[model samples]
Target: MESPLKNFAEVARKFCAWAETQPVSTENEVKTAIELLANLSSAILATSNLGFGEDLEGERISDEEWRVTYNRFGFLPFNYYSTFFNPANVGKEEPVIGDLADDLADIYRDLKAGFWLYDRGHVKEAVWEWRQSFQTHWGRHATGALYALHAWSTNESIQL
Candidate 1:
């Protein structure tokens, strides 16, 4: 089996490339979005399968970097949105503008932090940080983005 860290890093790289190059309103927008969502989802599963060694915090930015910019309508024709699911409001809906750029950017930012540590020979820190952020942050973004992309692909409403 491939190392989870490597798999995650590769996914991050591919996502970055896609975000940077994917044009607006492509003919196969749905297909591209589906593929991107699949990669992000796989990275999340890989994170879950990996162990949380050392339980240490990796380097984090006090202020996050700028949001990743991308072709807004490149992945989907319409703007997408979703919100955190609360058990108390299981049936209620709160929709925000959930663009693909923001979704990919969230995943990229967390992945970059871990990859930075890994590149600097802090392997343990990298894995620990990646897995931790996966649970607390990026994982939710991936899932939400998946919901949006899948809905777009199927011509259905974005259901959270």
Candidate 2:
């Protein structure tokens, strides 16, 4: 059987490669978004079993670098959406505005950081980076973006 880490690495690499290309058409972008998000969602689940490693001090992405990727996702149909703190208190609690582009950009940055470590032969550090970021950051963005993308893809009449 293939190692879980290896499996995750493959998915993460594929997602980064696709994001790098910056798909042009609206239809292609939507389809790719759904596919990538679904695959990433599944791949991330495997990281729970990965052991923690010492931080390798991977490079941080600057705001300028982030905006480059964020802007590349400009073609996403749905940019903004409403998010609730608790589903049961949806009406009582104020909904926060979520951006699909922000989610994609953030996820990309997080994964890219791990990539930097992984490519440099720091496999354990790479796994640690992925798992830690998944818990603290990108995981939330991924779920939110996946939910929005799924909704948009399923319903043709859903307006932006």
Candidate 3:
């Protein structure tokens, strides 16, 4: 079975290749490609939360469930909104998972900004933002980050 990262990379690569072969004069194709790129970013951002899975009964656990579990286990930064929203918990523990969650949110926001720039024909700015997003959070994995970097470098629709 292929990893989700591999799947995302393959799809992104194919989209870039398709975008390059498309005529820039075709507004519809360009729009479609840009949308696909945005969707790709969203997919990657969503996958950043690595550990939740559905139960045997097919019920998925809520974020609160996982948050509380992590908190009970003495995980640092136990102030996740789903579990504890108290302001007092702010400086308690410095859990790496919590930090990663924050990074995941930033990834989504940056991806949206990049896609908007691309849609508006600011390709260079879009590429720069996308590159920034990847650089900021890419340390979590080897393959996914490398593939994303390759896609960014080779995609003509992405300037800079």
TM-score-sorted candidate list, best first: 2, 1, 3
lDDT of candidate 2 vs native? 0.82
lDDT digits (tens) for residues 1-160 of candidate 3: 7655445445455544443342344334334434554556654554333332221121223456444433332221222222222325687844332332232223334444545555565545544554545556432322232234334345645432
Q: Write the per-residue lDDT of candidate 1 for residues 51-78, one digit (tens) a residue.
A: 5556555555334342334333334565
* Candidate no. 1 TM-score: 0.69
Q: Please name the candidate that would achieve the greatest lDDT relative to the true structure.
A: 2
In model 3, residue pairs whose N, Cα or C atoms come closer than 3 Å (at least 3 residues apart or on different chains), thus clashing, are 76-95, 77-93
Candidate 2: minimum summed lDDT over ten consecutive residues — where? 46-55
Instruction: Output the number of the TM-score-best candidate.
Output: 2
- Provide the lDDT at 127 for model 3: 49
Report the Cα lDDT for residue 148, model 3.
40
The per-model lDDT (C-alpha) reads 0.64, 0.82, 0.41
User: lDDT, candidate 1, residue 83?
Assistant: 57
Model 1, 99: alpha-carbon shift in Å? 4.3
Ranking by lDDT: 2, 1, 3
Deviation of model 2 at 27, angstroms: 1.4
